[model samples]
Target chain A: MKLEGKRLIWQEYQKEIADDHYFYARSCIRQTFFPGAEAVFVKIMKDELGKDIHDEQHHTSCTGIGYHADVVPFDTTMTVIARQFALMTEAGYENYAASCVTSFGLYTEVLETWHHFPEKEAQVREFLYKATGREFNKPKNLAHASDIVYKFRHQIAAKAKYKLIDKNTGEPLKVVEHIGCHYSKMFPHKGIGGAEYPYVLSGMIEAWGGEVIDYPERRHCCGFGFRQYIVQANRGFSLSCSKKKFDSMEPYQPDMIITNCPGCPMFLDRWQYALSEMEGKTYGKNNNGIPVFTYEEVAGMIMGYDPWKIGLQLHQVSAEPLLDKIGIPYDPLSKFKGKNGEDLGIPETPNYLKFYAD
Target chain B: MQKHIVVIGAGPAGLESSANLSNLGFRVTLVEKEEVTGGHLNKWHALFPSLASGKHTIEAIVKGLNPGIKIQTATKVTGIEAVNDYFTVSGHNGWQEKADAVVLTTGFQLFDSHRKEEYGYGIYENVITSADLEKQFASGKEFVNRQGKKPERVGFVHCVGSRDEKVNNLHCSKVCCITAVKQAIEVKQMIPEADVFCFYMDLRMFGRHYEELYKQAQEKYNIQFIRGRLSESTEDKDGNIIVKVEDTLLGKPLRIKVGLLVLMAGMEFPPATKALTNMLGLKNVSDGFIQPLDEVLHSNLTEIPGVFIAGTCSGPKSVSDTMADARSAALAVAEYLK
Candidate 1:
């Protein structure tokens, strides 16, 4: 009953499983925007967690985002899920997960619907079987990388031999965690815990010996609204969403922010910059802009894993100063090297490095 | 000392700005033209992507307020003025107040779809706007055509009263594309046998799970999408509406007959904006959106020192964006007063 010292739920799963032979479901955005998140998941799953995840190219994207847009039909969602399952199963892999919350939800929903409605399931299975000549069974669970990091949080903290000490306050950090809409809001009951308090990313932040700040707009959507920023190009909407979280946490003055979804990070980071441009007054004197990270990158930081492997450098909003403030000795210029050993101006120290001392 | 801050409009933006300012230790008064709060959200059952209960979002915002925030429903802002650093706001029934700062979170009205006669919105029995559909769902009425039969086919026309040079609305109503997608999905949920189609210039799933929702509607619900604006709608003998559109993607003219047609309407600044702007000496964009002091910075900030703007009052925005904008506006007020 007591959650104080106990490891979070997902932390237990990572320790129990040695092999990470995961079927990584692809995201359409990942193919375009943040491939680094997938890279981080793969690197951690292989080198640290000691798992072999299959990155088989034959498995097409889940096609759930398009379906949610009403551009794709329900039959296509079923077909996509079926085909994804067949590819995973045919490759002799069972455990499957997606970096996208929408994909995870879609795969889970279609599988559940198929199992509950035998007739619908039969039709889909027959169609898939006829097409691929393979029997497809849904994975035991379709997960986000954040869900996994949260599951194995204790191990991550235990393996973390390095800690970040704050230079100014000489104290650990009080953090704010922003989870995306897909992780909880889209299907409130589908994930591990209730949407209001999805302990996945927050659990990881806490396990790392940092405080999690609860802001007023904690549960609101990031307002990426798909192409609203592009089609109509309303910077106000995107900036406003970021402003809500920033304002809520301003009183707390969190050292940095942690996000679970890619979309959340994109909006939170880009909008912060946009807000700064639009307002002329920076959030927190331009220094108050919270550095955000995906759950895997957070775990990697806690575990003292390779920063490059975690893809921390690819972040739009630089995390360098937070790393220095946290007392993590990162070579600002030496780190985040290009293929030819050129620095990408990425900070060596993670924002939370100083908050928790090993 | 309680500093009076008057907020005009009881919509999500106005309500949120009032509630947040009130919480930050200011005496706030919110005026609404409607008898109820929640602005547009009250009319809908759920929001996009997340499909969060609209009632809950409105309630959550309301719950954050303290007694200091006075919400006056069925009230209108008649005039506003700035004398030096302070502002005087006036309304009906001798309602008058002075505020150290004023926030114009006055929300937007839906553009009248009937103006686009080609769509046959008011003339056709089967054609309706997104707001009309939302009103029907809120009233617990099932979606049925004039004949009272469960409609087998539904067509959604996007960009009605928005993004048309002819109407002088060059700005895209950012919410229409996603709202169309959300409503299409909702229709599929209500009537699984119904074939829903969206006529749009482009499917903008630019948000998180927006693309996913679009995909879900397509892959899960089998909705059809045509990249075109409906040219016109005509009734057949059976009363089914026939829509004529040039499929932009297909580069050909096409005619589609459907039982019901839903138009995705745009946003317009309420008529009160001009009166308020004139009285308060607050500046607005040419299109009547309350122009922020700086588009890049002070987006929620007004030039009149204490006046702030949030939500679609500044520009057209989705519900999620409006709430976030409201929070920022709240922060702007908090910092200014403090």
Candidate 2:
């Protein structure tokens, strides 16, 4: 990306987007915390869009968390990636789309290394062949699944029950797009937009008729400094990073935040919850916290999917107010209580966003 | 006829070369795209350490220009082509000139702060690049936020677009460090109530008295120096910029909010240099700046005979360095013509 004194002409940035035959790689954190996001993504691809997407049983974790957390060695991490590639070869898909930003970055980094150092490539290839006799070729295109969604954003908007705008005010809902650091910072050339001014998430927000907030700290790391969060004492460093973003963006009065990374949405969501507990201060109006959604969950929301099925309720911060803002109707009782079970009416837990009365 | 020479750009280097070559009995045409000369020197309020006025310095250089030299204002050189020993330079308005020799003092532009979008320069009103801050100083205007109130704290962030492989700019901009230090002091001088901080990966005060100014920023001016690159900057409720950075020296992340944030934008090759090189068949080094015949001893000469390079157009340089380079280029042109 050639920048003339930091000006980004909206039409100049070009990125490659493959239309079909995607081999999806899921994130461990996403599966553990927000499992329904990938499920909803797969559902959209299969039922809604009629695209062939693989959510294979054999495709395991990318081991990026372990590698970043510093427990797994670099060689072991490369072998795991080789094994994942072998699975893709068997699946016969040539496009590699990663659900996690870290995984996408790792894939980009390892591929770049392979491009530069053939010996390292030979080593990983040999290890894969010896372990499972599974031979694989590199994918024709490597991309984050969010990039694919961004590419087809206009199509998704066309099929939508609603535009991401405030119904009453007739204003486009103010949305902040948080790009994961690993998504572009490590390998800018590989990402949808180059590292400095990535337009991947913002493009989707714009396409869906949402006002993408260009807040001061828009490109900040989500504070998923891997070891910073994994290590107990260093967690302050992790949380402080998010606070910095929050303090910068609070003035914008953002209705929602959308992220391309698995860990970032979780961090942004949970940190708001944690901040309220620790400081007794809330950001959103009337103490209703701003909703944080992964790009996949948002794609599902805009497509009018059931909120529960998309796993938004799993978030610590509430998405209830945002649902109300976008004019999406849901049974209030079902938000706090379970299905076909007793109306264990909201007496036990205090509803965070006050979707249920105290 | 006396040897006719063309000097592209109107910065210190271009002006110095024109004056020196004209004094050497060459009829020089100094081409400037702007109505005025001085380039970046006009933008700065003062230089570092000594705190000398930038305007007066440029005036002194302008005063030295030989009267015989012809000045062309608001004229851009579109292309340069070698025909035999003479080069034909053409640009907008059907403007064309033939030169026995051409000296490209095209000069460098500041690194784009928007490339480091994490700093929130264009997006946030309180967040601006060093060049923007210098404009505020040069104008002597009261520093104000987006809401037109005096800022309480101002931050100076170094290495906005330099020393980062993400933007494909790995070379140090060479002057931004000391420039930040100078600006921090100036900010403190004007707004004594406002706290100032410098966030940097490394303080490259590799010039004379630059380290002293760094020390003075801490000791005399009370400007805080943190040894870390800023991670990101965000704006608060009142348009205050909030920054997060790992205090690498402290081994922990530090978050601070300031009323104003200034990114120490680095230097990069000017776009005009790219066009000029294409027109003149010049090659740039790997770092994107124009390449000399050889970096060490033949820094003034380009691959084509009678074609010379000067100032930050070749690479990052200080005002004094640019002038010296321009003078050396003048000497080289005189020898080439002889």
Best by TM-score: 2
* Residues B242-330 of candidate 2: C-alpha lDDT, one tens digit per residue: 78888888899888988888888889997756977987678987789999999998999999999999899889988878889999999
| Residue B311 lDDT (model 2) | 94
TM-score of each: 0.48, 0.82
lDDT of each: 0.73, 0.83
Top lDDT model: 2
CAPRI-style docking class of model 1 based on DockQ: incorrect
Candidate 1, position B73, lDDT: 78
Worst 10 residues of 1 chain A by lDDT: A349-358
Best by DockQ: 2
Misplaced by over 4 Å in model 1 are A1-358
Q: Write the per-residue lDDT of candidate 1 for residues B1-338, one digit (tens) a residue.
A: 77788888878888888878887888888888778888788877778879887888889888877877787778777867777778787877568888887777778889987567556665567888998888777777876877797889999998888888756677778888888898899889889999999998876677778888888889999999998887667665466787878988779988788999999999887775687787767776767678889988889898778888889988998887888898899898888987
In the order shown, the candidates' DockQ scores are 0.01, 0.25
